[model samples]
Target: MAGTSLAGWLLLAIYLPTIHGLRLAQMGTMSPNGGDDGVDFRPAYHITPPSNWMNDPNGLMERDGIFHVFFQFNPSAPIWGAPHWGHVASRDLAHWQRLPVALSPEETYDIDGVFSGSATVLPDGDPVIMYTGTSRRQELGFFWQVQALARPENGSDPLLQRWVKDPRNPVIEDAPPRGTNFQFRDPQTAWRQEVGEELGSLWLTTIGSQVSCVGAAPMYASRDFVKWEFFGYLHSQPGVVPSENETECTFGETQFGAEGRNWEVVCYFPKRVGEEVIHIFKYSDQIRGRTPFGRDWYVLSDVPLAFTNKTVPGQGNALTPSLRGAPFAPAIIDHGDIYASKFFNTSSGRLLWMGWSFETSTGCTGTCSDGTPLTDARGWQGLQTIPREVQVDLETGQLLMTPIGEVEALRSAQLFEQGGMKLVPGARRALPLKFPKGGSGGRQMDVSATFKLSDEASAEVSSTGFKVGVAVTHGRTGALTSVFLNGSLSAGGGGVEELEMWVDRSATGGATSANLQGGRVTLGGVAKEVTLRLLVDRSVVEAVGQGGRVRATSRVYPAGRGDWGLELFNEGAAGSVVAGVEAWEMEGAFVDDLW
Candidate 1:
């Protein structure tokens, strides 16, 4: 509303792909008041709402070659509040068309707000949405939440613009006795199974909640979209202290509340790995230790397809007890600011994963953790991480998530390329990529590099190890964000060292929520080679190591409008060689208003 005109706002009703496709460079000079505020923090290629607060990617689905992304949005302000479902659609993941609000507070049950939910395709091929509706229910004695349903008015519309709320909404009328109304929400996509011709098919989904003293993802069974029955939780975890030996799935003590107090955004899916079908269950634990904001934790269980459909809902199947003491344990997918993750199968029958990357900069009126007043000046709050192709590693029992190949379409020019460079201990050299000729210098890019330990380095098995990595720094202010490969070699001929993908943001100039985050990088056993891929979009930094065995999504604020700097550094007892480095300047996606 600042620099945007009435006509400019009205232009949203007209779809103009050509106008939005123009590079940000050719979009003409920007003003501080305009939508393109010339702010360095506005990500060029990432999916952000046209304006205001946004979080938790929701209602993800595909039909007719077009993909749709819905999110928790506050249409009025740059901060969170009573939410509406904001939407966008794209034929390809790289380009998006921003649409109007999908669902708003209309009925008395949802008058307060419309929260997070998912979209599932029905048997007949039409997609239906199930969401959480919130309002003060006098009978319930508190602000309550319940499940609701919505369907596209016209199934033929690929964009799915107009949605009609089901009249019998508050579909699952009340919360299960195990959880309070306030705690039960985020109904995930439903899956169907054929159970003999007599029973036909059964639809099953889960909702996040707390039951008794354990955090749980409670399952629900339904014959039709309108009626749902509570079945036992698919998984649950009792509160416990954090231990290095335990998986991230184990509920840990935090300042917010006791572990298992509550869980949010429960997601489930099945993928066949070789001959086994690994059922993947994921949830967002907002009260987990180390991450006061929240973290997405997942576990892979080898539940047979027959047992899953036959005894799951009927016997109230709970897989936690069996997985707790097993080697196949729960793990943190992306160890950073990402949370509330959800997945959907694409038109090509590929499982694609996405998560909400919330803002690290505080929006409060008072000073932030960094002593700054506020950082919501840009009129946006969150974004969706680049869609990742998901696959289960049969050998390691881990999930492999890599940026979808569709993202390559955004690559404009090759920014930098290098190969076979030796890196000695204590050696630090700058790269030419810091200050590129066009676009925001090093702000928007796709970079991938491979590092291999030299013969001498691989021979040493010291108690303490080496660290080698690429660093992104603000040339004017020296603000730094470093992603490193930390490990020590084994005594054997082939290095058997266990490597980790560690991200350090302690020196980043501006406000940030987390300083250090990392995960074990399973480099196919011996860890002879480490590959690091980075997708840098202004304030957001996503790093994938070992072909997505480990990932880190961080929000970094680098101070200065001057050139950026990229450097390679090595520290410790030995040296490593940079096998290869490839980088490309990415083009901004057109997320313009479309009716």
Candidate 2:
């Protein structure tokens, strides 16, 4: 997916001198509320490129108390083509500083593009980046992908602004026997363990691919970081037929791929919860109804497996027995516009996840109807989701994902706070609020609320369930996006109550409104209040429900723009209560002149 046309790369090279360093390096420092071009949809607090296209957080690691983020970028244009490794650094996670381009497609093996990969620290404490290099194979006259390695030009540089590709390029030159050549990319960070007495401290990594129409992450082992050998699979699963037909079916046709093929960006790691240690395997796929487009998927290996470093008697290594033969019952991680997520553990023991939030539509090329330049026309295309802290439930083995607490630093003085507000069925009421001077016109907000049924028995007895909603609206055009919570009895013969959070953007009128997505969790029939926390940044809206047990994120473009208004409504036959509501204006994260 990272490879672009040769013409695109050639065109980009002509402007490489300006795009690489001269322009970005000129920006001195980033302030919380400075350096924006008045593009309304550009996120204030999210991580975005200073200009041009950006996607997929790659080689994420913290070194020398500084966090380094390398991502897929196209400095030449605001579209996906001719990628280079764009660099950024941060001491506090909330604020960011731009750096020069880290890696480019200048070599023979990677002329097409420098794609996604992972970063790990060596035994000597120097960090190395393992990435996939895409190039056109002369013999076959087609593009091919191979695994490669790179290191910082000067390891002592805390920001890691410059990188040098290893002369031993294409460390793993060819895909394994059963793996498809082009489908293999995005190498996972290798883990080290002592294998047999003869093979000591082998490094193992997984490459995502499809074999026999089934998805797999084939593991490869290297004694050093250069020489490699084939190992078995970390996880494999066949795709299932989708149940919904909201869009044109493409997965089974030539346009997509074969029926049950799920392969992209393999991530596997272990975490200890209480007295037990469990493994998590994650991948990205474009299944029709499950993820419906591209989204992150995960499978929790619930069974107990020895995660110790000591060698196992029957299994050649401890990691092999723990990772191999793991079952593939996968679940969607986020129900909205997030995909290609990368995870890193901090020195403080916080496991963080970051993902690419791609544009939902083809995007406007020149100007919008109102004569303002669109996001693409302004020279930037994508932004990253806020970093999330992820943890597993000990009893249920479900994932709990929440926005990291560091983001709270961006919140301004509270703009609106209310409690004990009630609304009758089919009624809507506005919540009046004042905005900060020179604010983002309600484009940035941190809102938290709790909704509960005024009559719980009526909702349980009814078949359709009860719904309570909060609407963010443009007062002039009357366009709005609604976040609703619906509660109902379970349909699976259990008397459990099911609580669902759904976002409706049909009135927002943008490329992102096409998908009406929702996620639900079981609440044991006697559950009481449903809590929601929403983080909004212009086009992006992320909702965390039931204390991060369920989450959905989507993009919305309102027809007309001004300061936003908030309204509370009850859509079900029963009444509902807004126990508490709080909202705050958010400050910008980066101030750069490149925009």
Candidate 3:
């Protein structure tokens, strides 16, 4: 789909608003399929997509003050096909401003893909989009799905530029009964159902289903947002992981419901405050595996369809599996490589999120890992995991996820600081907080630490207590990437002793692209102070324990250069670990005019 030559559409409407209001223009991170240079691992502020393939995080929305995001692109090549909606904006989600591809597949009911949906700002402020439109109905070769709508051809350029697609096309054509529009699609992000009295002012949504095989979401209402009305499956797949005696087994009662593992792209998140309201669902790709990894599950429900009064004898009100006990127990909120997306709303109700970090589809079949060759430069895959703010700890419901204090305004200084430091038993330690400000070595960082296990690491767990770790190396081809706090190997079986995380990049050879990327996380008992938080850019590290239950994202590619930075090991043979650490120096959210 690459044929725009009217002088490239009039220099793209004056270079897309002067490159979205260029805030200084050094324009970092620019590979877009060119000769590579590494540039210390890209991601200056995260939310990439100036080049090719992007997954989920579609139609996100915000208004007047501006914030749209929209994604799932593939504009002419990078990888996946069909996709289209890919826009960007920001009044200050930290200087982002890209906009151009907002919805494509250019017609005939979305010629092929315009997947993942959600985005709204109505109430009279104008801004509405609800997507999921495919189209390959050769009399039904299976791929028809509907639900479409778009707007903003002129809210007067809130940076919205041009949209407008509601020819009534497939505003909800069908697909839910036999369930094939490739398993329904993503929808969530349309709320407003409390003007009471018989669903007045209705406008609720929640697509993403699977019917007979479990995993569901199907529930719609709409009033003027383009006719809809499903009202059926509201929370199935209740078996919410339990098994070893704890009961709870619904993916149609096990074997992961005949190997489909269900669940995909489902979001719900209600969240309200000042009047208190919460709900929460969020989902995406679960089990049925040989490497099924891409989790983001959640449960805590009280609204948006969670165990909704059952009735699925022959699939009437759907949500089957004979619901009865264990009403809520999903939990997983993040195992990193987040997906789909959620946690939207705001105006004073603070809490923002945006996911989709996928890109581990190794059908690579020939040279990668810097040797190049997999074509379109691996089609510029995924990115966009650093837009958090998410809150809801109202007493440990845990989802605190912080990364948005405008990312500490992108740091810039504070280089290093320590406070307490201990490391008995076979010791080892390294340090070099942020370097590469101007002398140029690249690696951007923003670390924060606090690990304490002493008391001989909770009174001995045999040896290996002091393996407290942190390494992002290259000190001459030791080409590293480590993260360990071996609580007897990240909290193995014990009586109240959790909090575990161990990541080993096999010396920079780990994270085979799509990331099944390991880095265990136990976070259960063992607590004497455990707070690790890292964000190291230069091949993305991520890692956030203690504040977000437990996380550990991945992506590494060392390649070796000079001594490189960061190090602090602390092996053990005696036991005792205590740390304090703190680092800084980030700055670089790309395109300051393409440095």
Candidate 4:
């Protein structure tokens, strides 16, 4: 009778797929393409230029009412070699228009490729981009920072034309003492006006590794964006004493509260905590300042300052509006992998965020690869995560972030709905849903669920015990995020067991992974019940689980037909309960979109 019943249910499942507008025949079982192994996962929004290789969003700024986003791109293939600045612009920050390669490796100064940089509006109101120019000669690679001026020949067709690099290249060369690791690169420039000076000041931050350390970021001040002078080290790690390398990401204006009275210079650095990589902030009241000496200077214990914008005719200047002593304790922005984040001052009056998606490795290893190393083939490697919009909750004082809103307008085909359902163990449920009706577009989508586990189960596991599977067909192959208690479980031979909630991108062939561990908690509670939110775009999967306590993100590129479905797995034995499964389609929210 059980066998007959199971067969009947299988037949019903097939029929339900058709009724729900799903093409079951087209959807295949777990494979690289059918599962989470590729870069074309359905996304909440669609990227204008499909895919090859993209990384580190550079020069993210608004000019002439258009938001320009430049990225480290290699158009030759979907790998990470031969970097160039790929340009794209969007009016609404959702739908994007791909522009020509803004900056390439044509000049001897930038013969290798253009690395990462930032952009600011010049005093003349033209857009100025400062970037690191990397060159290679006789198997040796040297990086020199450069700046270029760009203007819209036609205000209406900013995306139609190309950005022109300055004729005088190598505006800033490697710091003197050619042997020192202090090759100035990754230029982050911003304009500020002094109290008594007629002309405003330009602040630039670059990464350098001296003889004592590997990579440390230093700051410089410039009267003009073109000519820059080294100010001092923004922040450095322990030198030789406990010897560790420190590399700083982008720096920006730190704002405090709605009044925006206090401002400070905020920059992020990756510090090694045990074996894991953690991101910490350094702030100061001195408007134009650098990192001090010793371990005390290593941590930002002092209060911070406030920054405000002062518009000067065509030029917009960000001045040190106000200052504060410093926080009694420095704050850590994220415990997981986040690097090179750009904070955008959007028209909507809210601060936005875009950062480089780093893997467990450091430096070039953080970049994605096609599994095979570059022996002699000129193929591309990794890409960066799409730009995300960040939100800070005033009540709890925690940061919440998601991709920008414009990406959410591209959803089609809605299939499953569970208003409220109590999930039970031993029994798995499959809901009928429809895949978006179109060619294999980018795989980007927003997935969220509110879960409640049994008290006994929670006590036993310390959390919940169940797996959330996506894009599963008849077989059990697909990506999954499993949540369970913290304690160890016995497998069979008395071995300890650990519950893992992660997104597997093996189907897409892009090896990206994310997960949550027990001991991790946000402000709310011990993550008793979690709202697992995932943004699946192309080859990238940004999964925020357990209220952001556990973030498992990876990129996958699969090679199969783009057909997907959702499933739930029960890791627990019989008599377990999995309750409250809710999934919602999400849209991007821009700073202006928030009231």
Candidate 5:
């Protein structure tokens, strides 16, 4: 035992120094080991590269000019299990530096894994994190709940990177026992208290369900960042009849209406209503305490709200009067099979959102066992969408979201441009463009176009049938990339299918499908007419169709530097006329700038 203890001490002595050495290397300083090892890692802009299976991003906090983002990750295998908190830091939102895993399931309470959580500066001015603890026992079955406290290791010393868990964890685990029907989890913490109230009191929102029903977000208040008291049920649509499953990632602040005359809570949740996956919202006028209030407190019904909000106090709440009652429709932030998103405010004042982006099947299969075959076989499965900037419409109160602006900082130079192209029936043409000198000749490019389709041309194709092709080559033996839109029509079925395609230059000629390699989608159902936005980078592509539906992402790559061109095809054989097309040069940054 003594010898083993000595060996353990020896390991810590050696490992701590090595860890500190790596931290120093990241700071542009030489390591003590006499190596000039500086890391030059950057955040992926197009689509987050598949380092491994990444779920909801947690602990997104900014300090000392550095922004830290922690995510739910399964590093050992491509799929998710044995969850750990993966860490990455960025000086700008655009460029990211991957750090070591921040939190692992080292303790028995969290043996199953550390699930989703949030980060905040505690009232004592220390950095603290709150997360869910998942565990299993023969008697208890599978039980999980919210937990939190100050980081065990907190100081100004840059070399100390370990986070100590609070002794008194499972901080808010107040559900009614294991089989009692109520399941509670997901704690989002923020410091807000009245003048007379405790200074460090926190308001936490989480998903709770009573057997047979799902996803009723309950509220809890905490003081000292440890002990929590049940507040009340935040919001629920009792009679609306949830379709078997429902869950919420996070809830925004309580917005006060004009002159404090009204109040509303902003919550975002995923509801499996019937056969559709809908992102929905509900509003409230009264703040219920720990007890059940009258039916008037339930006056706010489940209504489809927009993504607009006015900037006020209460720390980035979605409640805003400025964007209330506008014609804006609820924009589907992600069109592909992505779900369970959480939004937070950055130090720069922009609203950023992150969610899990993977194919429906990959999530259902439990393990990301077949990485190579999955990439080759399933194509565009098991990846994440780039974080996006979210906004609320001033007139419609609906949400409007897009890729963050700082992402554009990554653009090296303009490769090509074409102003006027008219699409006619049964005829296809390619508009070739040249890459700017000194740009990444081997690197991929983002191709975008906005056009108006003629009514006569619209009548020929099915609402969901349209194809766009992009090719890149020096002259010969290059690559061909294609994006297809199908089943986009309304119930009646007759509208133009808007196209937005993200292509990868690296995988252009590969055997993998275009939709999976480095492609992404943002598609909408058929519309009378609409605008299209397409973003393609090295490993990801994002396409936003019309206002109705959005195909968020897919994967594809280009082979080599060559003449790049765009092609439009009518899959239904019904010719469509194109009005105009415009493409922009994109920019990449070291980190995302919130302002």
Candidate 6:
């Protein structure tokens, strides 16, 4: 599922000196229009490294007067290489200032790479980090993985600069007791455990595993926050068989952990709604036909044993409750390309979930194609999906996932709005007659729309289920690469309704190259209404239906200049639906060049 595009790759031999006050920095020559389009493929509001590559929103902590954002970065080149913990800080999550490299590989334990990790700020202060280390030492002789710790050199800096690796590195020095290959990494944030011991917080770090080659998440726990012990499992997917000879399935393996989605990278977050305590479990799944090969997977379950703060070993629900033991099956977190998520509480008194959006694909996504890198001058790789507030939906008995309100602070203008519009079956209209010729290419914008089936079309809606779509950017050749959100087709009676999403990227139709893949997200059956809030960037589009009761996102490349056209589409019968829609042109979040 890896996709590539020839995005006018220009060679750059230019090197700029670091800006004053910044410790580590670099920049490459960038084109005004990233591609041939007037719009650049880079996200206007999302976070990407100033140069080179970035993956996984790591060590996200908001404290004091600054918000710390650490990520897996390859400062050496745009393509993946020796990984380092690239650093940045923001007071408002929107504007980020480049900081020195937080953590790098220098010690024998991490000579190969300083991998992904988490940040935990104690009650007294400072942050303690637990990360994975991989090495091939002269004495150890063979390559292996181990857990490590780090702390700020100047814990008082507020910026949290210059990390110091623990001399007693590889704290969890041994591998899992179960023979689950080198699947150990990604330590979760710890919570205080023990009946009375204040320092005895319960901790669990997950490592990838395969029982007979099926994916599993084996969690390890620690009480003192230093010495660790192997706990039990959180969940497992039974029939994943990794390709024996193919080796290209390594991109974002932990940086984004895309390769292990089918059976790896189990992330957990617990929350309580009203009187019900809920535990959320997420992982990637690609069970052949059940899921689209390129996207990530998500699931939720109940916290077993009501979760007590007892400090006993292997007593936390994470160690005892099986994912299958939950009330229902795993549900998709975001219908879009989001996975390897982390959830944590911020100093602002809000719990948030952030995941790496597989926006730009290279090599292979879930499955491989002829290995070739994409050429679009996106200049960056990977981005953190908009931060979302995670809570349990007591009414729906599911998770309520909504983009944080802070995201709205990025909208700079109100471009277009329509009080209401009528749609006939199989009818289409160019949006924003304000431009006369469709649109002048509002490549980055926000769209909000609510659709209702016409009373006269209820019979047709129940039988065929009408479709309402927005061609974010389409072509002049009459080709269409639009995202369609359709709904409920009944059988006979007592039928369930659903609002389903499908991104149409067939190249023969236009807009984008055929290599760009799209998939569907069933927002369940809808009775009559579907409210949508969509964020459209130059090459990316993310949609949230009914405040994230369902979500979907995808990366698309425009195939023609005329493809910048934005329009409204209807499929069913003429005058079958009515909608009230509005759109706003978004402003870029990264403009200061703080580096």
Residue-wise lDDT of candidate 2 within 1-595, one digit each (tens)? 2333443553444334344233334442221222222355667798887667888899888876888788988776667775788877777678777777788887778888888999988778799999988887677665577888999999988888778899989898766554556667899888775556666667888887654445657778887788887765665543223322222222233113435564678788777877666677788876544434576887776455332332111122222322234433566788888778888877787888888887664333211211123443344667888888999875454778899998998898677998888777777888886788888767799988887555544334543356777788854677788888887533322332667888887777644445577777644335556777889897789988877878888777654446787888787754445557898999988644222
Model 6 TM-score is 0.79
CA-lDDT, candidates in order: 0.72, 0.69, 0.60, 0.43, 0.45, 0.59
Q: Which numbered prediction scores highest in lDDT against the true structure?
A: 1
lDDT by residue for model 5 (140-202), tens: 554554465538375683322457788887676665221111144445545353323333334
Q: For each of the candidates, give the backbone clash count.
A: 0, 0, 22, 67, 64, 23
Candidate 1 TM-score to native: 0.86
Error of 6 at 439 (Å): 13
Best candidate, TM-score-wise?
1
lDDT digits (tens) for residues 1-595 of candidate 4: 1212333432333223222113212342243223422223333243322234565677878766687878776655445656677776777776565566666666666766677777776556576777777665453333334433344444455553456676666666645121132234556545363423343445544443231222234455566566666544444322112232232222222111111111122344332324442333332221112111001111321222212221111112111111133222323333333444455556565456565553221112323333232200212233344555554333333345555555556444344556455555555566555444453332334555555444433334433334433333322344433333332333222222333344443332323333332233234323334355556554445656555434544444444443444555444542243444434343322222111
Off by over 4 Å in 5: 1-52, 122-125, 139-143, 150-152, 155-161, 176-183, 189-202, 208-212, 236-332, 359-383, 394-397, 435-443, 453-529, 546-551, 556-565, 568-595
lDDT of 1 by residue, 142-204 (tens): 557889999999998878887889999888865554456777789999998664566677787
Q: How many clashes show up in model 5?
A: 64
For all predicted structures, in order, the TM-scores are 0.86, 0.83, 0.36, 0.64, 0.62, 0.79
Candidate with better TM-score, 2 vs 3: 2
Model 6's alpha-carbon lDDT is 0.59
Cα displacement (Å) at residue 353, model 1: 0.8
The residue pairs that clash in candidate 2, if any, are none
How far residue 579's Cα lies from its native spot in candidate 6, in Å, is 1.3
- Weakest ten-residue segment in model 6 by summed lDDT: 1-10
